[model samples]
Each structure stands twice: as structure tokens, then as C-alpha cells.
Target: MSQIIIDQLTHAQKVRILYKTILRLHRGLPEELRDLGDKYARDEFRRHLQCSPMEAQLFMTEWAKYAVTITSQLGLKGKAMGTIGGELDSNTVEMLKEDQVIQLYELMLAAKGLEGDTITAKDIHNSK
Candidate 1:
């Protein structure tokens, strides 16, 4: 979506569209990753349901970047089975508050666990 179109949307409209877009794009990922992405997005969106207006704006902005980055990665890779995560901007990480940073750290751990699981599954499949 263009900035012009985005500019016309109300906050609620933008939030709804961005959240749905995140879930929709995850469809291109592997089933396990897709399920994780869907659940995380849903939970995060719900957690922010009562945030302040400024907080909501920041949250939407970050997720919008995430959606675009993932879509770009999927396009470049011709699939979403591997290495879809681009390096996160250091500046963005530095800007996160303490609680947000903790949440992000937990997410990283979860993603790492999934990576190990995927590798183990592939090893077993190859062995068979």
C-alpha cells in the first residue's frame, strides 16, 4: 500500500489492515513457522488493544515494516522455507523500552527453538 492510501486510513483501519496483512503474508511460510507467526501476531495485537495512541502508532509502524520485510524476503528467495529474517536495525533495538526488549528477547528464543526443531526434523527425514 502506498503512503497516500495509508495516510487516509484511520488508526483503527490501519491497525486492522496491518494485522491482517501480517497473518496473510505468513501463509507463504512453512506450516510450522506460519502457525507460530499467526499466533504471535494475534497475541501481540491483542496485547496492544488498550495501549495509548502513541504506543499504538509505534506498534503499527514496526509491524508494517515487518510485513514489508518478510514479503520482500519471500519474493527474493522464491520461497519462505529458509533464512527469511533480515538483520534487525540496531537503532530500532536501542529504541525499545525495557518490557518491549524483554518481549523481543523471548521471541528470539522461541524462534531459535523452532530453528533447532526444523533442523532436527530434516535430519530425521533424511535418515529415514
Candidate 2:
């Protein structure tokens, strides 16, 4: 379908955009979904990369999905944290905070097309 094509393009663009953003954010795509975590996932990703093209495609697709989901939630969470007067300091440790984690997640998600534009707590609340 044409919609699917459009969707694919959107995702591709998101991935490219997020690639740079992720570098700045100090977060890489989650390793678990990318099969880059533990021995199994890493092995799987490697095997896919070395073997069947379809498998490679699947691997990338899964990573993109994971990235998007994580980023969107991260952004939403960050907005919430900001409301409470909490500020995130620069460091990987700070990434553990729910709000900071969410913002990182949002940046990734926007790159993947899971969500777009800036979101606010009210936007999230209204949606639900």
C-alpha cells in the first residue's frame, strides 16, 4: 500500500535523524531489542548481519521500533520531571532518572516516527 511506503520512508528518515541525535544524547539504540545485548542478542544480530538479508532487515526494523518506543516515553517522562523542579545534570548516570530517561526515549522515538513534535504532559493526559 502507498501508506506503507510512506510509513517506511518516515521510519527511514527518523532513523537517519535519530542517528545524529542519539550521538548527542549519549544513548544508543537499546541493545536488547537490537540483539546487541548479552551473548544471544549480539550473536543473533551478528548472524543476521552476516547471513540472510531478510534477517538483517528484521534486526534493523526491531531496533528502530524499540528506539522509537523508548524515546517517546522518555520525552513524556522528562516533561513530567521538569514540572517538579527537578533538573537533569549531564552524565550517563543522570539518564537513569525517569524524566531524563523519557526525554532520551522521546528523542529516539521522534527519529523513528513513533511520535512527532514536542509533547507536553497535558497532551499526554488529554490523549488518554
Candidate 3:
């Protein structure tokens, strides 16, 4: 069934799907590593943009397999990153609890122009 659907999709559509899936997987990574993962994924995709149709198809197939494996290994569901639709699921919510904390810490660091330092009361007070 899925193979039928895949066959029907245009090459561009397949590329779009693969790109979105990779981005979603990157989003689920720990905050500190997200940027690195995103850059690597983006560069790899860009590098393949000029490949022949057959090469593109082969790359997409392999990428799709890697995406599924990574998602499973990370205990993430298809809905985990809310990339397909803009709605969160229970599993996504649970996953976000820890991610949210890391995101917040990252945001705070960016806000204060600091790198890899825990925000302490003294740091906040000194900044003011």
C-alpha cells in the first residue's frame, strides 16, 4: 500500500517528504545537538539536490529507512515532532517535558549571551 503511494509521488514530493522527516528527527534531538544535526542534514540534502533521478530515488529510499530506524531507537513516534500536523500527541507531550527544560536553558543562555553555563540567581542578579 505504502509502496503504491511512494510510486505515485513525484520526485520533488519525495524529496520534500524526506527533508521534512529529517528536520522533524533533528527537532527531537537534545537541544544542544539540534543545531549540529540540522546543519548536517541540511548540507547532505543540498549535496544530493543535483543527483540523477535514479540516484535521488535511491537516496530517498535509504533516508526513509534511516528515519524510521532513528525514530524507533529514540522511542519516538511518527507524531512526536508534530511535523505532519500542527497538533501534539500524548507521546509528544511526554517527550517535550525534558526537551522543554533543555530548550528553556538554551534560550536563557542565548538571551544572556552566555555559553553552556547554568543560569544561577547570581547570574540573573548580575545581569540586571
Q: Compare the candidates by lDDT and give the number of the best one.
A: 1
lDDT of each: 0.77, 0.46, 0.65
Q: Write the per-residue lDDT of candidate 3 for residues 1-128, one digit (tens) a residue.
A: 39999899888887888888888876766665567557656876898889998878777886887687657645444334423212335564454444454554566565455867765556434533
Candidate 2 lDDT tens digits, 1-128: 36676476763464454454433222333433222223333344445545566755665676556445545644443321222112335564343555545555564565465766676667444532
Give the Å shift of residue 39 in candidate 3. Answer: 0.7
Among these predictions, the greatest TM-score belongs to: 1
lDDT of 1 by residue, 1-128 (tens): 79999799898898899888888899888787788889899999999999998988788888988998888878554467468777667786776666666566566657766433223334333422
> In candidate 2, residue 39 scores what lDDT?
37
| TM-score winner between candidates 1 and 3 | 1
Q: After superposition, how far is residue 68 of candidate 1 from its true place, in Å?
A: 0.8
Model 2, C-alpha of 37: deviation from truth (Å): 6.4
For model 1, the stretches where C-alpha displacement exceeds 4 angstroms are 1-8, 76-78, 114-128
In candidate 3, position 98 carries an lDDT of 49
Candidate 2 has its poorest 10 consecutive residues by lDDT at 77-86
What ordering of candidates by lDDT runs from best to worst? 1, 3, 2
Model 2, TM vs. native: 0.29
